[model samples]
Target: MALTNSKPKIAIVYASATGHTERLTEMIVDASVSQGLQPEIFPVKEFDLKELLRYDIVVVGTYTWMNGEIPRQLHSLFEAIEQQSGDLVTGVFGTGDRCFATYCGAVDLFRDMLHAKTQLAATLKVEQMPSAEDRLRCDAFMNSVWRKYSQHVENLVAAKP
Candidate 1:
């Protein structure tokens, strides 16, 4: 049988207390679809490890809470990713208040974990209540990261001689 190449599947998962992170996830989903890729959105609280591993690319979103730590639900997911042996390509984004001591706290946590664990593709940070420019920058960042990741995957597939 002849094999056909297909577009990669992308998943956007988020944990939000005040909806900021969820909104960002929705934006990523929309952008991914607009770029002619398969994409889905999931709340991190309801995300499953098996489902996450199925995606070729995963975008994680979170809102800062308490200090600069990830929420309990997402911590579990991060732990799972850390323990797994699979190479999960990931992008990260978050929303937080700049007035706080740490701006984009959730994003900070993601950077730390990604540095220690998975191969982090990119990270975008937005204000808690993002401005028009912030939104534009976030969208642009997503586009650039997605394109880079796509190229990386293509190279990997082509190099499998």
Candidate 2:
């Protein structure tokens, strides 16, 4: 299907202390918009679980802390997401210093939790200090997601015939 005509609803929610993750979320939102999808951005602190359930795709972004863990504020949001166990399609992303032994630690946590509970559409690990390459990577990842998701929806529609 043509992305502009897909009318897919996408949400990019993130927890960021130094703004890197938040910036990445914005990039994803921009890409979504360019693809003709309805996109929204929410900070973990300001996110509403009920609103999240309405989206066809939920992209969760987080930053890793000193101990390779998600920020405390986002922990509760993650728990809430896990508890719902709805059929919402989900994706994960994270920004962290590549110097760390466990790069993109938060992405790992998000992936593990979602795999153990809900269906995951994709996972993107973006670098903390983004360069031109990083931006291209993020755009590519978003494009792949849009393509895969549109295909999934198309298959569902075709099966109903």
Alpha-carbon lDDT of model 2: 0.75
Q: Cα lDDT for residue 34, model 1?
A: 67
Q: State the weakest 10-residue window (summed lDDT) of model 2.
A: 1-10
State the lDDT at 53 in candidate 2: 63
On TM-score, the leading prediction is 1
Collision count for each candidate, in order:
0, 0
User: Highest lDDT: which candidate?
Assistant: 2
Candidate 1: TM-score? Answer: 0.84
TM-score of each: 0.84, 0.83
List where candidate 1 sits over 4 angstroms from the true fold: 1-5
lDDT of 2 by residue, 1-161 (tens): 22233576777888888888878887777767776777778887787876756677778888888767887888877887787644455788888887888888878998888877655767888777555566666777777677667666666576665
- For candidate 2, the per-residue lDDT at 95 reads 88
Give one digit per residue, the lDDT tens place, for model 1 in 1-161. Answer: 00124666677888888877777776776667666777777887667787766766777888887777778778877777777443556788888887888788778777777757755778888876555566566667668666656666666677678
